[model samples]
Target chain A: MTKVALTPLAQSLPASVPFVGPEAQERAQGFPFKARLGANESTFGPSPKAIAAMQKAASEVWMYGDPESHDLRQALAAHHQIAPENIMIGEGIDTLLGVLVRLYVTAGDAVVTSAGAYPTFNYHVAGFGGTLHTVPYKNDHEDPDALIAKAREVGAKLIYIANPDNPMGTWHNAARMQQMIDAVPAGCLLVLDEAYIELAPEGTAPAINTSADNVIRMRTFSKAHGMAGARVGYAIGAPDIIQGFNKVRNHFGMSRISQAGALAALRDDGWLGHIREEVSKSRERIIQIAAENGLQTLPSATNFVAIDCGRNGDFASRVLANLITAGVFVRMPFVAPQNRCIRISCGTAAQMDIFAAALPGALQAAHDNLG
Target chain B: MTKVALTPLAQSLPASVPFVGPEAQERAQGFPFKARLGANESTFGPSPKAIAAMQKAASEVWMYGDPESHDLRQALAAHHQIAPENIMIGEGIDTLLGVLVRLYVTAGDAVVTSAGAYPTFNYHVAGFGGTLHTVPYKNDHEDPDALIAKAREVGAKLIYIANPDNPMGTWHNAARMQQMIDAVPAGCLLVLDEAYIELAPEGTAPAINTSADNVIRMRTFSKAHGMAGARVGYAIGAPDIIQGFNKVRNHFGMSRISQAGALAALRDDGWLGHIREEVSKSRERIIQIAAENGLQTLPSATNFVAIDCGRNGDFASRVLANLITAGVFVRMPFVAPQNRCIRISCGTAAQMDIFAAALPGALQAAHDNLG
Candidate 1:
């Protein structure tokens, strides 16, 4: 084999995917997983209005999605009581993060994030050849203050925090989050990822403001809105910061029909309310189930329960494997201490019943495997 | 206002959007246009099977799309008679192009392309801080030899060539493309954007070779299969090259419903055949209309026509503006020689009739405006 002369940066990077999707696991196992709670997707469907809109526009799929995603953005602005100028929509918050990294962090630029936080953001940072500075979690929650300190120390261009974070379902109250925002270095942009905010406690979200160019709030319809399959998300910030995305973002990356569906989804708050109620109940049920199994579950403000598996990371690994073998797909934090737990997404009652029935057997199997 | 500092390269870039979508125009005009032919979308619609698949998957919009996009890739590989490893599915060709630019081209890296080939690609290169090495089109066709020579001279890292290309709808046959591919430098990756291949004349596409590491072919369901609104596209390349996309791609970027819709569209070739036939007829109608109007229409292999207004770009601009005012949404090429022509997409016979009715009035309106 001949050595192909790839770019120096490309050659330096390892071919790595952050998560092996459940679909890949199923393919390797040669069978489908019975339940999908790994990706923190909503089990409840998108709003009925969304479905109707998509169906109605299905035949019109030949046309490109409105590049501006005009209607959807208008609806989002109205929903949040913010100006449309402050909103920038993308394929997902994941794509938005990548674009922001490209905009602010070039090769070897210092960027800061929480350790054991969203690996996808870290992946984007690494992808852009940015020097990543990580601040570890404090008591299973992201230490936003430490993140700000790290960013300030490194003279970082970007500092990131997820308010209602994934993998742990722990969040900081907006008031607490604001202190960290105030501490962000003058030159750095604070990327406040609120992907799961809609399902989080009421105080978890900050008030939408157009005054600050250094802070951006990320939101998604994948959580309480139950449209993860639609691959839609947006960023809200000062008009200047929001407009900055236009320089590098894929203008036609959106699906026109999906935009229509999202607009329809946004218009129906009743459906969002119903799903939110269902999610809260599911979270309570999961906590109860974890307690019944003699496991401690973290206090969650989002839609998932992070159950402490009781032991080391090794023990939690066994539990996750056993659950996966049982066709139950769940995930966990990748860092130590937090890795002593497994995270389960809130799902339908029927799905939870399957979980309730399987937990005891899986726990025993995990113990046996560890031994 | 306190200045938020971005990277040096970012500060240098103007926050420019490549294209303003028709929807944006609609909002500016305070009403919707009568016909939607501006973006070169298939107005004929997608396969019934695709519509049905998307509708059926509407309830399952809670699940994120399969990150691997396995089933769709497998089906596409089968359709192309290539191995599954040859494919990398993405949000759309636009998104993939952005990633490709970032992966291969560095700051100040020379990347060669047509001066007016695809502004979206140019936008990506500029975003990545690459110095675009542009060659003007020769007689409305992308000059392969000139592009290759420039790439060799500049030590270009990437080269973009869209065959059966956009805007102008001109093409070089498979033989010509093969010659160009062989001439491509060893280190340079020829991005063969065969987006319009499905609608092109037979023998227009070069035979596929999954092992061709030097070239990557991009295809989309947007043009012929008519699923542009779903926002699914894929690249076919050697295994090693395809795997490189994994290091940075948004793994779950694909919309699950889009995968289903595109897969269904791929399987229904009969619908594609019908669309191709209709497109052929529409192209002929545009040519006839152009002849009647005393204008010259370029020969096209794709679903659009570039009509030479037999005058300067200013006259063509006036004509385009007049056409827009007549409620016929059409676009012209941005580059000078090409801008002497106004490009029109193949719409339904009804839409063509609208264009037909409007063209004479639009030309007169241009004269009136000039007066």
Candidate 2:
């Protein structure tokens, strides 16, 4: 049997998933995770109104989703005070990132991001055969100055920064973010990922400037909106950049039920406010729990907290492994120095109770194993 | 005022949607279509079981879908009597098509398809800058032999053919398909799109041979299963070819609710059987309606029927325009000769009654406008 030919780029790429999902780990361990917090998904769940909307739309799945996502985009435009042309809805922020990378990065073009930013973004760059340049995090935060300088030096086509960072949960205030946006070089696009913005404090995000030529901000329903499995996200950008996505995206990719759900979720500010308050409470609980356990918790503006293990990466990994074995699913940063901490997503009071009960025994197990 | 840099390929492409969805047309017309029979979606909708599953899953949408699509793939593998490795699920057949083209066809590479088969597939090819070669349909059917010959002649890396072809619902028997599969060039891959196969008769589909390196078969929940808005589709091929999708696909792209809906739909073969029977009845009714109106209907194994307008492309266009004005949404073929026909999807009896009532006026309007 002769083999079919693959493109040189495809042949050169490794077949891999950026992150192994918690479900896969559960399947391997032959048990379900008691608390599903490893992936930074909200345990608070989607708004009750969104759930009702999806349930109502479930019987109408015969019709294809509106390829333009017209209703959803119109509502989003109104929400952000921008023209509908400035928004593009897709399967998720991950899908949007993939399309954005394909639009801007050709083979051998330089792309810049923090050393340990979102892995899915890095995966897309590599898939498109773009050369990636990385700058290290400064004080556990994405260093915008270093990133901007690297992009200019390398003539990078795109630079990525998560406003309220993932894995580390650190954030930059609006003023600092506005300066970063201003510093973007003429030819470089800045991908401002604000997936966690809804959970952050007030003024965490810079004001929306839909006409800004070099900056595209991404937000999602997967965070405080509590619909990660709904797979709905949108990018806010200049009309030209937003329209560019149409040239390559799967036009009918959104689920009709997801559209209805997200619209409802967006409209119910009361539900969103409740979720924010709950998440904030959970965050404080996580911080207090860490302190009680003799660990240092990083200052966080996002839904999750990163607690310093006060040792090296290995110790953090050991602690995480022990936690998982003890029926608590948690994750950690991968890069050195930063990897001295393990990340834990905020969950319900009961889930936090479980985590609080498990951490001391897991730490003891790690210490005993090391000895 | 400086612009962000776009890749040369991006700069060269037009920012356009492949298909203007029926909903957009409705929005433009300032009213909903009285009958949405265009787009070939199942007006019958998904199974009740599937709807229930999706509604149930909606409350649990805070978690990301299993990136591996483990449970659904296992169910699909069991249903098809194949290994899980032979299957790769995606957002839809459209997304799978895009990924397949990216895997096999690079910029400037040759890809083959019927001239007016599936425009979305062609759109993806163009999006990736692949040089497309087209063969005319033989007697309104996708000619497999012609497609094979063109692939060999062009040294094409990929060839696409839809069985029980769209636009003109004509199909070839399994033996003919097997012969065509055998003719695939050694280095070329045959992307056999079997999206409509479930609506076709027995012996219409070529037997699955997952070990066959040159052919990959795609199936979807969008058509006969009536889950188009759910955006679930899968491809069955050699394990190696299936695995290659992981190198470039959006791994976490599938909506958790959609996965649940599709799984439930797949398990309810009884509902599928019921749909097939209903569609068969709808097809007969469509044929009778065409016969009463002095039109000839083509033989169709799929859910939709193509009725000959007994005139040229212009007359057919006028007929379709009148139908839309009469609030009956029907579509037609795009290429010459075949453009002499108008396509109508299988609808419920009430919708069929509306279409039957509207056809005579539409025909008269076309004739009166001609003078």
Candidate 3:
């Protein structure tokens, strides 16, 4: 009997995961890591009010979540001071990016992003059979000018940029970002992923302008609100672009419990203030630890810091491997000279102590192994 | 300035939601649904253990859920007496169907299903640019033979059947289903959606066969397990097809709280048994209420019962509208002869009372409006 055949595009695509969770690593190693920092999830838990809301929502799990996600969208609209029509919610930024790509990029269409930027975005583009053009990062920051230039050159349909970017935690000021936004090619849509914006410095994000048809900004509760597992993220864009999501999106995708948790988390300003302060302290601690170990650290506007290993990619890889072996979970950028650094997330004092204690030994082990 | 244009396929598609949610209706009506029986969700609620597990998982929402979903898949495998490779978990059957369409149906591919089967499936097929060929339902049941015949006639890549079916709550026995499975056209996959399977009679489902490359069975926690809001569903299929999901699925889309809740719910067979008993009672109550109103109820193998209004689609539509106005959120079939009936979900005793009280008044109002 002839077996069912996959589409030619599906057959050509690789069945590879974008990012492996720490749980998988723990399973492979037969033990849990002493410090959970990989994947850039907030080590600080979500607000107590959010937890309470989720617990209450648990009993209501028999009813499907609102397909429109009305209450949460209303809360977000009021928070952003934008009309609800300008926002579109999804399971997460990952899911939103997939839908966005499907809407704009057909087979053989061109999309552009930074070389070492979010792999998940690239995965979505590839899954849709879109031709991706990568522009290299200039001085560890996503070079917006270069990206716009490449988009124009390639006649790209979409260009992706993550301000306060992942892996390196580097960001551009609002004025610089505005310049990049203004420079976007007429026909190209700029995807500004602000997943880490809530934790970034005040001027890191440009003002929200929902009238701009050329840009869509993605925001997630995963990093700053400490609800990564809840999988709530949204896009702020022109009403037409936001409405276009209904053409292909799974309308009832969001979890009811997650909606409750995110709404509560958004309202608990005191908890957010506490998290910001804690994240700031943790960043300082991470920087101090790097300095104490005689390593240079990249200035991070997000909750993670990129510590330069002062060597090539191979050396940094060894350091990361040793750190994982020593029960500290950390990751490094995929492309280098960025790969010459290891990325570590901000955690509680106890978790940071574990990382600090493990780092010197991990470095020593890497040196010994290299020698 | 030229705005970034959507792909030709996306541009051709209208941005219409497959189902207008009860919440949207409630919003329009400026109130909440008193008895939400439209969506076929279990009002019996999830197991207390599942609720507890979700409440516990809420505190740990800072970490991303296991991308592999190892523990839940392993548990499902053990429960089904199959290998873990045979199982693939998704955000929901809705999301899985979308991914499945993306995998097998490229532009211009043909897919087959009953005409009034599930609008969401049709939505996915259209979203992927697949041409859907639908056969009319036979005597309120999804005619498997007709579906198979159409699949063969059209050289279709997929055929979707939900048994015991939605809207009509009718089903086929295992032997008949086995015949359909055996008759699947070469290179055509049969998507057996068993969303309400647990509530069906013991002999309703065919034996699980992961060796069959042309068939995939979908199961969900939404109905019998009473966790619709958690959005957990799994597919049992050949390992190759299951692995193919990894190519396009959002790897980290599932919520950790949901995973924990589903795991707990699956292990609590007592709660499931209780839910089955409760749903059976509720179904009987609904049938009795319909009979009292001089309406005929269809034979149901699922949680909901379809009450025939003894009139045309327009009359049934009026009954549904009046029901909604009376705060009884029930739905009716979408197509011709079947649209003569209104579908009501099994609910708690209190909710059933509300539905029962509202049905008489709704019927009277519908008659008055029609006259």
For each predicted model, how many residue pairs clash, with residues at least 3 apart or on different chains?
1, 0, 0
What does the lDDT come to for candidate 2? 0.93
For all candidates listed, what's the TM-score of chain B alone? 0.98, 0.99, 0.99
C-alpha RMSD for every candidate: 1.7, 0.8, 0.8
Order the candidates by DockQ, highest first: 3, 2, 1
Model 3 CA deviation exceeding 4 Å by range? none
Q: Estimate the TM-score for candidate 2.
A: 0.99
Worst 10 residues of 3 chain B by lDDT: B362-371
* Local accuracy of candidate 3 as per-residue lDDT tens digits, A238-275: 99999999898998768999999999999999999999
Better of 1 and 2 by lDDT: 2
Q: Write the per-residue lDDT of candidate 1 for residues A1-371, one digit (tens) a residue.
A: 23235656776777887867888889898888788888888888889999898888787788777888877888888888888999998888888998899788877899998878888898889888899998889999889878888887998889888888778888889899888777778888899999888887788787877878779999988887888878889999999998888877788858776787888988898998998899999999999999999999998877788999999898898888888888898988899989999999999998898888878988999888766
In model 1, which runs have C-alpha deviations exceeding 4 angstroms?
A: A1-5, B1-3, B368-371
- Among residues 3 or more apart in sequence or in different chains, the pairs in candidate 2 whose N, CA or C atoms overlap within 3 Å are none
Which residue pairs in candidate 3 have backbone atoms (N, alpha carbon, C) closer than 3 angstroms, thus clashing? Answer: none
Most DockQ-accurate candidate = 3
Model 2, span A292-340: residue lDDT tens: 9999999898889999999999999999999999889999999989999
Give model 1's TM-score versus the native structure. 0.97
**How far in Å is the alpha carbon of B306 misplaced in model 1?**
1.2
